[model samples]
Target chain A: MQNLVDHTVEINKLLARYGVKFGIYKNQEFHEQLFPFDAIPRVITHEEYSELEKGLIQRVDALNAFLKDIYSEKKIVKDNVVPEDFIFASSGYLPQCEGIIPPKGIYSHISGIDLVQAKDKSWYILEDNLRIPSGASYPLIARELCRRAAPGTFKENNVVDNRNYHKLLKETMDYVNCGGISVIMTPGRYNAAYFEHSYLAERSGCVLAMYNDLFVEKNQLFYRDYKGENKKVGVIYRRISDEFLDPMSFNSESVIGVPNLMDVYRAGNVAIVNAPGNGIADDKGIYYFVPKMIKYYLNEEPILKNAPTYLPFYEEDRKYVLDNLEKLVIKDVAEAGGYGVVFGSDLSKEKLEDMKQLIINESRRFIAQEVIDFLDLDIMENGEPVPRKADLRAFVLSGKETKVWASGLTRFSRNPDSFVVNSSQGGGFKDTWVLSR
Target chain B: MGIISIEKANNLYWLGRYTERVFTTLRKFYRIFDSMIDFDDAEMVYSEYCQRLSIPNIYTSGQQFVDCYIFDPKNPDSLYHNMERAYDNAIVLRDELSSNVVSYIQLALDAIASAKGTAAPLFQLQQVVDYLFAFWGCVDDYVENEECRNIMKTGKYAERIDLYIRLQYHTKDIEKEFTKFVNRMKKTNMHCNLDKLAELTEIINTKKEFNTEYQEALNCLQGIVEVV
Candidate 1:
């Protein structure tokens, strides 16, 4: 472990050589920056991992069931477990996918659930990212470099191998494949996660394609080559957002989308991983209902608990949120990637009053939660160890079965005072190692 | 083997051209630097380079030429621009080549960025040359797929020939590089006309003045293009 700490500088230099970077846009200009890596590994015991694996599978299964039910029957909405307006009025509920079942009947196939352990040693689910989650690539590459930097570190401990993410991804694509080739469709190389898109394609033996490379001809998706050759694509793990996926069906102004891809998908000639409209389940407001969903769909109690959250959408909940506006963390339901998160204690008295009024006026737009006293991880800064806010994004893949990858991306805030650990927010990352018993 | 998209093919071809442009220009600039030690009238060489590459002359003096042509990213024909083009080409084709080969280009670009505006610019130039040589060597040794190797060799030979002609090297040197180029082309299954090679050989052996018979070399290039 001391050897691992000593070689941190060399490990980081090697990461730079491999171009392990993330892109962020500021004022409409794209800039690529390395996501800093901490030498310390977040160690998880095998027994704890087993418990987490069960909980993650239960949560993802419930989310998938919730999506299937929402798109097909609306039984949960009709039963009044959740408000009818919440489902129909969500900006994420796409009418285009109504009654259309994806191949293999799986939605949210690849889910990234963000979690944090509280001071009391209880893990709380922070958010769910069912819609094209990034950051899995960061840890995947980091582990490889770490092994090279400190080969003896693995011999000393029984850390489960986490490099099978690509293999697991390939199997997921294969399970849902209509019949032909699997392709990872990207908007272009300028996308923030373009490295992930291309790297996953190479590792999974899938074709990395751009919008121009794919075309919908005769109601089938085909990847066109330079020599006028076309290969039929059966499953496409598209990195672009749903709105920019098909120009004809969604955002008509989008040049990055295929014109008639939705029609091909509608015809059941291809499968789209984590099918479109999964954003409805990943909504921050909807996050408060996931534990209930696990019980409702799986007929089993949720093993992991969500942070004590209150949606101002309800009259009773709104009254409570308004009174405790100074103590809770107010989040805009539609925002993600560490944006639109406002800590109640960080706000001025006047701002808190204004937030209470806004929640009263438009209660559906906000969800307030009691901030969990999350445990801090130690990161080396200068020459000494400093504690920083960190959160884990555990990837749960639902192929024929839902299983959690042994490793998770543990991102820590570089700013000691800040709690946001999003890579887009200038945070650093560490590899989470689940020890094998 | 032939999985490259049309856009990538075009990129690969241009990447070949641009990388060759940088390599040949750097070699040519070394001679210009040597001439500058004796003659103060070395600015004309920059203008000649700009003309040969079909880029606009934006520099006014030798200092400006070094700044604009060697380091300027905005100038499409600058060495920085050529390296950027090469980086773009290599980025999309990573699966076709060894990962180490792509890393070399990335390292070269990083070296260029860090070395720009320094007093010792030629020190950085040496690093870029070394990286390009490593890139080719890695491709030859590590890249196993024959088609991938052929496409890269095609680009390399095509660019080398273009650079050799543009630099106006002596007939002896041109013949030597041209034979190496032809040999690589043949190995890659991209053969050229034997008649053109014979004609070039005749010109190299008989013609004493290289500048007077530039049209004959241009015709030989035209023949090679037809073969490709």
Candidate 2:
């Protein structure tokens, strides 16, 4: 294990040499920061992995069914499992995609479900990132570096190679490819996950294109080369947000979006990875009903459990949340990336009262969960070991078959007391290794 | 293998031009630096440099010119300014060129930033020159696509010709460099007008006075678009 730590240090240095960095904007200036890697990997046993595989597939399946149902049928809403107001009033529910059925009818094709182990050694779901989840490249590159640094370690231990992430990604894109070339569209290099975008494009054999490089012509997406040759683009794994996907459809003022991409997507001329309008399934309010969705759609009990969540939209749940305001963690449903998450204990008495009143006024906008006593992972701080909050983002890819990448991105909070492990919030990441037994 | 976008191609061509401009000007500045060591009044060389580069002479003193003309990011002809331009061009074109190419330019820019306070400026200047050479070498060895090579060569040759004219190199040297440049362009499949090539040859052979007949040479060059 000590040798493994030494190897990790060497691997991290090599990663820096390769310019493997995540870019962030601070005070309107772009800065590239190294994502810290921990020697300690989250090892999953084969039995555990098999169980997780089943759970993840079921979870994503339900999420995809939920998205399709919300967009088209409204059966889930009419059945009163999820409230109509929650579907209609939620910011993530895109009305533009009311009747649009994506290619192969799959939404949340690549779902990044955030999970954290409890102190009791049981896993609990944190949040679902159905839209443009990143961090897959970090572990994929880290594993390569680790293999180079500790060739003997991999030889000795039967660790499953996580390098197949790119292959899996390519297969997933190809499986859903409408007709032409696969393109990984980026907003630009200044984006937070630009490194992942470009690296994945290179590894997956997909052309990395920006908005200017791609355009809609004759209701088909095409990538324009420097020589002005337009190659038809079939599958586009765009890293941009849904609102910024097409200026004509969503944010009319957005210059980073293609002019008529949504029209093409509507025309079923191209396949979008994870599809558009997947945010409806990932909304914090919707997250509370995922376990129920698994039972409803898959007709099986959820293997993994969601953190005991309460949507304030329900009169009963709202009363419970208001009563236990100080014990619960209240989250604003529309916000993500560790934002709008407030620990009830962190607030003063006056603030708690204010929050209670706000939740009462805007009941549909908030969801509360009992803070799980999650296990803390030990990471090196200065020279000594310090316990820090860490969360795992397991990537689940659904194509012809649902598959979960063996490796995951384990993000840890740099601040000892902080629970937020988002890269935007001064957190670092470690490569997760699912051990083969 | 080549990830050439229209924006990236434009950036790469300009990057090649700016990097060459900095390298050639830095070498010329060394000569001015040698003259300044002996003479007290060194403002003439700085003014001449500014005039030759077709830039405004804003500096009132030798130190000011060194600060503004060599290191200022605001000055369009400054080494610091050109490096910034080179970085901007190289950053977007990383998918096309070798990754090392971008890193070398970044290292040179970093050296420039740190050397701003150093007493001996040539120490840093030498590093920049070495890095620029390595950048081109890396591009040649690592960049596999012929179109990318052609675009880079076009910028390199165009900038070299401009520099040769400004520095007033011998006609034989100019002819040799221009011929190599034209041959490289031809090898890389860049279309150039045969008439412009003939006119360039004539000008080099005749040693035509540039001040009086430079406009005619410029017009002849304008007729040939370096197909990127």
Candidate 3:
């Protein structure tokens, strides 16, 4: 609405007043910058959102099934649905997680599935973030501020209230809580998503904790209270990475990790939301198999489609990718936050040759996909509406039942020529308004 | 959410101390600055301030004193330094204090940073004090956890009394602050050394001896509350 658009500066000031920011490290020095908010929301019709909700629920359910299978039985891999190499060779695979079924049998408790709609109105998932997915808090808080900024805009729009994200998150945590208190663990204040970590904790009524504040005693995780008392912690929604989560289990040099936390988790004494080693399911190379996973796990056709993709690991797909190298997009499996994506059209000829050789040498590390002609959303530039490339990250929470949040974080590239819509890469975000109608 | 970690409680306490430190010292500096306008004893005024605070005489001139003491980030005794420390502590306690309460510290920090460029720097500095007041008010309104608020208030009163003694305030003023500080300490879950509190009380109640025995009172007050 124009009313919301007119108060862009005012909305941003309130965001600053609430210290809404993301941290970035450049040249080894940390700088916290405000995540710019665009007032023109990315609205979805009720019919379209209905379709998306079913597809997202189906997709996340399949992903959850795959994660459980990968960690325990490996039935999907054994049945030749997903390759053995994709399970073992992927960097996200942790041997320690094997045979350790998480509480409630849910792995990807909070999934941020990135999707982009084409010019033809068909949606394609960009990628799945199963491990420590962020940005939900950004849109969650933005919607609150937007409502405050333009009450009339919300009244006129009939937007579904997206403020229940924390409630959804808390329910997800509570469902898996073994017996005690729930806590949200952060690496520290310097993390890029620290604002979300602390903000979510505040909203969800969970104690925000650092590694030092938590310890394991008698295979039970406990939070050390100020009075030298210990309170049992049954659920930990950790924001730290898998490698830096438990020093004894994963990266031994991780000072940010709580020592022996994996022991506690493995004993079924505590629950770690989005169970560790989820990277294997969300791997870019494994993305090619999600549709098959939906079919394999749910026995249903995928409601949504993946971007036409080719895993260079396969000889047939490798040939197609090499022949159409310039026309496709290349993504490294190990990199995230929009760092390792290379549009074939953007690369020089010499660079293309180097990339082709690198892909040939390390076929398992890359996946190429046809560039989706995604729709460009309008963002106010100067005084006029200008079209910019944007992507939506829909949060799907897997508790007792899988549910798709109505609203999502719609991030847009600030640069006209760029397609990387990640906050770490200087992207601004808009609130995604799913119409109640 | 209600139960706080030891680290958060410490941060809350220090956040209180640092913000109150800036608020009290800056007001004291303003008084000293006011007296400097007609008198030619600017150096004398600053030197006495440094002696009272027991900080190194790092400033060479009155203008340098004003600039460094109020605005310098490098000077440990500077208002900017204390404000930064307050923010550093406040930033991590967002969950305990809530973002609305934490934003006040940020606003106060921003106010101090903006005051550096103004012609009437002292006038601009008043904004910092106003924001600090708002920070406390917001904390009271929004921070639902009682122990967190009590710990922070304890730190606030503790710093107030410490600074009052260092600046050689009137005994009656110190007595009023001491009573409030004891009240907050009692409300907190943190262990308070009752013996030390009693000793600090005895020294303060000896009204005529209070001024001469103030150093001992300061020592007693510092150890009265233990983090354990």
In terms of lDDT, the best-performing candidate is: 3
**lDDT value, candidate 3, whole model:** 0.92
> Model 3: per-residue lDDT, tens digit, B90-123?
9999888998899999898888988996899999
Q: What TM-score would you give candidate 3 relative to the actual structure? A: 0.97
Worst 10 residues of 1 chain A by lDDT: A223-232
Please give the C-alpha DockQ score of model 3: 0.80
How many clashing residue pairs are found in candidate 1? 0
Q: Which 10-residue window of candidate 3 chain A scores lowest in summed lDDT? A: A11-20
lDDT of 2 by residue, A1-437 (tens): 55666766677766665567788878989998888777766677777777877888889988988998988888888888887887887788899988989888887778999999899978899999999999999889888877777777788877889999989999888888899889888888788888788778767768878898888989999987766677898999999998999999999999999999989989999999878888888989889988888888788999999999998888999999999999999999978889999999999999999999999999988999999987998887666678999999999998888899998999999998899999888898887877788
CA-only RMSD, every prediction: 3.1, 3.1, 1.5
Greater DockQ among 2 and 3 belongs to 3
TM-score of chain A of each: 0.99, 0.98, 0.99
| lDDT ranking, high to low | 3, 1, 2
Candidate 2 lDDT (Cα, 0 to 1) = 0.82
CA lDDT of every candidate: 0.83, 0.82, 0.92
A1-437 per-residue lDDT for model 3 (tens digits): 89889999999888887889999999999999999999999999999999999999999999999998899899998999889999899999999999999999999999999999999999999999999999999889889888888899889878999999999999999999999999999999899999999999999999999999999999999999887779999999999999999989999999999999999999999999989999999999899999999999999999999999999899999999999999999999999999889999988999999999999999999999999987999999998999999999999999989999999999999999989999888999999999999
Worst 10 residues of 2 chain A by lDDT: A11-20
Q: Which residue pairs of candidate 1 clash?
A: none
